[model samples]
Target: MVALTDEEKAMRDGRDGDAVAAAMDLLIRYADALGAEQLCETRNVAGTNTQPSPAKTKLFEEGGWSKAFSVISLDCDDDIEVPQMKVPTCQLQHGFGNDALGIMPYSERNIELQAGAESFYSSKGVNVLATCTPYQVGNLPTYGEHIAWMESSAVVYANSVLGARTNCEGGASTGSASITGRIPCWGNHLVENRYGTHLIESGLRMTGFQDWGMFGYFVGDMVQEARPVMIGDLGQPDLADLKHFGAAAASSGGVEMYHIPGRTPDAPTLEAAFGGAAPPESLHYGEAERRAIYDSLNSIGNSEDVDFVLIGCPHASLEQIGRVARALEGRTLSAGTELWVMTPRALRAVSDRNGWTATIERAGGRVLTDSCPAMSRVAPAGTKVFATDSAKQAHYLPAILGIEAWFGTTEECVEAAVTGRWRGSLAPAAVVR
Candidate 1:
């Protein structure tokens, strides 16, 4: 059994009522299952609760929000009375909303169900910052802060890029953490496990956003859940580039943490990445490897006649929205083609003020928010083939939607959107001096 403090015991003894006790119960069980010595305190949590599903729908219909929370969130079958969250928590993206009437096949009753759940959860202090990239909006966790977060891409970004600590948590665990403010102190939460397990070196310059995604996919595939130490002829990558990279890595492999020495916060040097131990033999991500990864991501596609172009997966940064808008400013989408840019609603508002939203909309593209097509398994009606700049999306959409996917740069995707054909060709590799 995992050791619990007096305070934790008090919560379990029902000092804070049934919901918290149940949450505590779940946390203790979770900690023990992980072989964790104790539960660590956490103030940040991100999870999903509002996505409409047959199970949640039935639960809500039978016993309302409390029953749903007890069963779904707390993993308890008891109809416990839910209470306000004990710590700061936010809802992750829950899929396209009711506003997607003409565009998506999401049912009206399901939309209503989602709205009701969102209203109920918000009243209980769950911030409905409905975006996959919560860090992009607010809720940026401090380096080394223990957090309970869902979403594989966000978990990897928190650990590898922002230096925060989190495992790829699930709904029940994050829900439990939200109420009790405690999580299992195993995996990425510990300093010892944060050290690099694999070393990746690249002499080929990986500077562009596309290159970052490809390199991340390669690293993730090679490491396959192991922590990686990366040293390369990589140019200075910006926020969006790293965002794309981390998301791709998490999707291709279950990479929850990595160290880019001198770039990522945890590892300032090669030695530091390995905790003073000698680094492993470097795994090279050279031209052949990059090409192989690209082909793998694109292998699902056969038709050149593109029907949809999706621009964001971990949610687009403001600059990415602007880039799409700029590319589509004077052009209209092809007759049969549709384009969508997924971003945080907050960023979408910023994009609106910057006129990027207007530009893209005018060119027959949408600036969507609060959810992703992959999570919903919903795309434009009759979308058999899609193009995207996100390696993560390219990796997932094919499997989820049973659609062909073309992986390329944002410009190439936009061109595909405009012409309704996949004319994209990989650029000749450029070496960074």
Candidate 2:
């Protein structure tokens, strides 16, 4: 029942090419599965998850790269070369870092497979950004533009922070949308679906990124999948605060977009955010709730001789990098501990140019790019305890890396990185309730 354009119909009928036909067929099926009545053109950007699987590469060598592309990306069994992407597309972060950095180790075959995957996508006209925060680089989309982005934190950032429209699309669907330049018209694509469904009146006066993050964790739990309109005297949070908030919310729950009246672009006014209607549900977050959320995120108890401290989950911005540099300027990491700061390569270059990278490196830390501990599964091998400022990382790394995770403020994490001890307290430093 999904309607298609004439060009799309032609491609469906195999007039464009086998690859186009296969991609179109897959998209049509996906639209049908979503119960969408029609397809709409994506106006702004499209991105695919960086998929560099050694198993998939072995399949490619056994069969062919075309078959692998068809089965893996297009979700079809047909053998066809992947057609050039129709819109501006970029690749999200994968499990590997850059060839030169070599921060995370990989086998010879795995490296070759990663290179082959990059080459294949690059040849098919995809800008392999290799980082999750493509917006920080060059793939910036303006307000209200439609994009097909797959990474969870990036999707939330794009919708809530950038005001661009995108759902929590999976890798396959985003890849199909990239090739066809269209996606099923549903779920955040329409203006009616973007309005706030819940109202959150925050009573706690948040001071730093950790406070905002803890508030977001509570709100995400309260609202679940519903969009929330936050009203408070938060006093204009910066980009890093919003980044931590969005990342934590997206991880703890399924929040794709949130509205902070007078802060975010879409929510200029409270009335505008709610679409002139009052929210049916309301929640209050105060000092006690913030402390509880912070304690819940920090699962480690008693034995907290820190082994590793990770700084970025959504990849640190230049400002965040500068903060980390300033914290560790005159200090060195503990003898038994390590610090790894992950950021996008573009921002890493900026850090390098600004001497922040050298400052951290001189302090016995590394500014890594493209991959994190959870993504690459590369820790210091004997790491028993890990600490991070990211609630998202704290939630996932324990299960992924099989270690106790301690979550706290950036300064507290820096202290752990310096002294190799968990001196973080769950109580709020100063609460205005």
Per-model tally of clashing residue pairs: 0, 0
Residues 300-332, model 2: lDDT tens digits: 544689988999887888888998999999899
lDDT of 1 by residue, 1-433 (tens): 8888999999999999988999998888888889999889999999988887789889999999888888999999987888999899999999677657677786778778888989999999999999989999998999989999999989988898899999999989999999999999999999999999999988778759999999999989999999988897687888898888888888888899998888999998889999999998989888789889999999999999999999988899998998999899889999999999999899999999999999998999999988888887888999999999999999998989999999999999999999999988778776545
| lDDT of every predicted structure (CA atoms) | 0.90, 0.81
Off by over 4 Å in 2: 98-108, 427-433
TM-score for each model: 0.98, 0.95
TM-score between model 1 and native: 0.98
Among the numbered candidates, top lDDT falls to 1
